[model samples]
Target: MELKPIKTRKIYEEIVEQIRELVVRGELKPGDKLPSERDLVERLKVSRASIREALSALEMMGLLEVRSGEGTFMRRLKPESVIAPLAWMLSIEKGTVQELLEVRKILEVQAAKLAAQRAQADDLRELEDALENMRQEIVNPELGGEKADLQFHYAITRATDNKILILIMDAISDMMQQMLKTSREKLYQGKYTPNILYSEHAQIYEAIKRKDPKQASEYILEHLSGVEEELNSHIE
Candidate 1:
């Protein structure tokens, strides 16, 4: 309700930023209806067109929902919805593949450690299932095992039971999948075999299953660091 007038070339982006800031500040909450376009126009000193554009963008980002006759209401923000635009942009940026791997190392190493400490029986079962799927996919020439490999990593994050970490994982899922596929292809072309990949994942799983956080972290780091080295060698 304390909106400011827009004074920029990109009026719509500014409007979106202001609205997003309001949401971040806990002023506008989920299920709260936004002011009408005419009211927003008066408040932001922007044209109705700009307001509409901003609102439309927010809707597309899953931040707002427009009812047929009930105006626009803020949607419950999901981690994936909030960070999806960043994922899309990163997907298009050049020379980010290595950076993505770096991020994976940071997030996944800690994920493995926390999973060892916090994983429940269900979490262990999920990890085991993913590992078994990876083992089965090793002999399936067409399947490539990338999906199972990604699932294995996702299961580890779920075991951690940390919502923010899980949110970050969900947000970068597409990029992660692409990274897996690309790196696997590169490694397979050289000396890495599907069985070798399966073994690495199995070791990580065993470490987590034993509730050995240190061993789990070491195994995961070793696996990822090797892959990172392989990726860098190809890139260079």
Candidate 2:
């Protein structure tokens, strides 16, 4: 039989996805033991290196655990458990903050457009509540926007009824907070007023409520653009 060529980069991912599918399909439940490395090496029709690399990644993702004295075992999927370390590692990494923000702006603007199409009464109320929090926090003793800013965006993400948007937002919350801190420090105290930001948010919220994607996007873009220009002017 002719050997099928397996590319190294994709082989690892192919092996990883195969194992994940097994668990997802309930062929390997949590706590079920995976076959030995030798067994996998034979069954997978791939190299030992590919097997090892795949297993190592799975272990890092908390999808599997390897015991030296024993063997590898399937693990439960838990988003709650993964978030803390993910947040911490992401928070300290350079370049991720702005990159993450740019990603969020794209999603959120589109999400706002979608929300305008789908928003219900309760969703409108939720956005209103978030806006209220921003109002209350304007005189907040805290120097930077914290819970108020997150609550506002989170409400919009929820209104979109999109799991992907919500998950991405949650994963990057830590970095967003840090970026908020940096941006706030530079521009929070001067050249702009809290009332100005509050008004911008109100405009976005209203546009979403009315199912106007264009205006919703415009409001967020205007708001973000101001901050972006300011950040650019001061970039070191």
Candidate 3:
């Protein structure tokens, strides 16, 4: 490999590009640790600060992970990481909330259907546990109900048994968790009765338990539709 001298004013970016190129060419494979900061500085003929900045940028891009004393390592890239930045940016734009709701509806409606068809006994038990947790947290003020709500949906996703679907769901899970908290808070404020939410979730669980894909899909879609309506009405 040619150790080219850093000649650009944007030295940090140049460093980032070179390392990125190495990664692309498989010179830096996933889980491979990089040379230390001092070694990188010497090899790239750039300041230590520039190397640090490049490493930081790579970390933010989900391409590398830095351990406090273990050095930086290339991460096994996921498609979700590539789309995450765009997904986050869209989340902040006007009209994006509805878009998120729509995406949630699509992914979850199908997940419900798949779970209905494929859920094993353990998967059904997980859903039951999540629902019971939500019921017990009905009066909780610390968002416990919301956490259970997220878990209920996650259990459904797990039942789908599709790795790609699971990855996509996991990718958007953080944002969805925040949204679920806002939704539970609104429900607590009496925007909608808590019983309605509980009953609907129970219906979803029952549909999956009975292996009724159609009912499962319908129940979940109806649940999402109600949430979207309430959220839109309360937003502004």
RMSD in order of candidates: 3.2, 5.5, 6.1
**Ranking according to lDDT, highest score first:** 1, 3, 2
Candidate 3 CA-lDDT value: 0.82
Q: Give residue 187's lDDT in candidate 1 (0 to 100).
A: 87
TM-score of each: 0.82, 0.70, 0.68
Question: What do the candidate models score in CA lDDT, each in turn?
Answer: 0.86, 0.74, 0.82
Best by TM-score: 1
Estimate, for each residue in 21-84, the C-alpha lDDT of model 1 and write its tens digit. 8987999999999999999999999999999988887787788999998899999877678775
Model 2 scores a TM of 0.70
Rank order (by TM-score, best first): 1, 2, 3
- The deviation in Å at residue 191 for candidate 1 is 3.2
For model 2, how does the per-residue alpha-carbon lDDT over 56-121 read when each residue is reduced to its tens digit? 877877778887799898777686544433443454455654576677778888878888888888
Can you give the lDDT of residue 216 in candidate 3?
A: 98
After superposing candidate 1, which stretches have Cα over 4 Å from the reference?
Answer: 1-15, 35-51, 76-95
In model 3, which runs have C-alpha deviations exceeding 4 angstroms? 1-54, 60-62, 65-96, 139-144, 188-191
Q: Give lDDT: candidate 3, residue 99.
A: 76
Q: Each candidate: how many clashes?
A: 0, 1, 0
